[model samples]
Target: MTASLKRFAATLWQADGRRFPAPLSLLLVGPLVIGLCVAFILPVGRLLAVSVWNPDFTLAEFVHITESPLYLRILGRTFLLGGVVTVLTLVLAYPVAFLMARLSGWRLAVATACVLVPLWTSVLVRSYAWIIILQRNGLLNSILTGLGLTDAPLPLLYNELSVTIAMTHVLLPYMILPIWAALRTIPRDLPLAAQSLGANAVRVFFLVVLPLSLPGVASGVLMVFILSLGFYVTPALVGGPETLMVATLIGQQTTELLNWPFAGALAALLLGITLLLVTVFNRFLGLDKKAAS
Candidate 1:
């Protein structure tokens, strides 16, 4: 069996040449390419087909999506929520990333652990944990009431605020990791040199550090925003009925309504929006150029 396998391998290599042919490379990746087509491309193609396939070709699903005020409102809210979560995560992650980048020894390890440990836990677990913490009689309310901060429990869970907070926590690490990677790449002496040339600390950061870190910022923002847009589990667990997002609506259409065509249309619309946002970000922020450099 081993000798036969060796002979087969030798035949394959020699049949191509000393240097692999383009077709050989394609053959080598053929399984992966086919797998992707089967797994992703075919499903997406089918989805697109179904969106227009209402017994005969039609645009009724898309027409309904556009004409319905509720879906339009939900779409707008999804984008708005994604934007808020991205901004929040960026703001919170930057300080942690900066410290992680600058620290040494055990301190660096500790900071790194703080950023990464939560990621090891399941998203469902994290969302459930937040529910426990933010419920009417939960830990947060207990502490606040105990501290004389409020007479009654504040409405913390089952709202936009709860969803935003949970998502920010869940997505914070993605923002931190990229920004930290960017910060680490920046030479330490650039800031020191700027300071030596009579630049103040704030000015050195603005001119030297912040400018260089924009790549990471852009990357982190893009990632967090996109992920947040598709978020379903976290929002469903923590969010109120009124806190509807595109994903939840899609889920409802797919499972509750059993409306496959409408679901496919919603999914396609979301995919289009995602692509549009990426194009806009790349065009205005130049994320691609910054990443290349």
Candidate 2:
């Protein structure tokens, strides 16, 4: 095995007995590395610089954010919103993904379609659909009135609840796909084997199945939360001004106020929070390492 690997490595390096010090794999990955630096790192570096220096070094933007309680509150709200959406999606998606994983034939196709069709649908369309269902005198209120559940239309639209519902619907498929992929890869016999060993359905799930599915759960949680934090249109469309999120605040600062420095600060702070959370998540869960295995 070692000799075969050595022969393969030698062939990659030598044209005429002259070895290039850099490995071929490095050469292959060089473009990807350069692309990442150009696309992600440089832009983020510039954003950080803009937050601190307005032609000259200044800490005013950061100070303004720190001194005012509003920005901090908005930041907290954004994280809270993300967390809520993540939990809702996880609860809703787990069963759906499990169903998708367990089924076969046309049933599987139907289940898969139900999960994916919404994805191909536009975000704007989906948000607008929520607005129609949730607005005063809309479908939900109409139904409630017809059923005599309420004397008048309940206030459903343009609130945190409305925003949460819309966002959860939009983000559900993300959670479902990762978990479905994970559940799909589980050995079909593991649960059956557990049952034979005197484990009931619930025990088999809580022990063998749930533990194996953690990497997917971790991935889905991270993706949904992060995506929710950056959401703009759904919140703006379904929520009132009082339901201010960090994205909306950043948009207001950039366009309405024309406060680019402050906007950069907000963006930088959000980026920092996202990175910090991702690092902590990966460290605690070892998501990528476990997922790869």
Residue-level lDDT of model 1, residues 1-293, one tens digit each, is 99999976766665546676566678989999999999999998898788899776889999999999999999999999999999999999998888889999999999899889999999999999999999999999999999999999999999999999999999999999999999999999999999999999899989998999999999999999999999999999999678999999888888899998999999999999899989999999999899999
Return the TM-score for candidate 1, rounded to 2 decimals. 0.90
Report lDDT (CA) for all predictions. Answer: 0.93, 0.91
After superposing candidate 2, which stretches have Cα over 4 Å from the reference? Answer: 1-39
Q: How accurate locally is residue 290 in candidate 2, as Cα lDDT from 0 to 100? A: 86
Q: List, residue by residue over 1-293, the lDDT tens digit for candidate 2.
A: 99999998877876765545467768988999999999999987886787888666878898899889988898988999899999999999999998899899999999889889999999999999999999998999999999999999999999999999999999999999999999988998999999999999999999999999888899899999999999998998899698899999988988899987888899998998899999999999999798889
Candidate 2 lDDT for residue 196: 99
lDDT of 1: 0.93
TM-score of candidate 2 to 2 decimals: 0.88
True-structure lDDT of candidate 2: 0.91
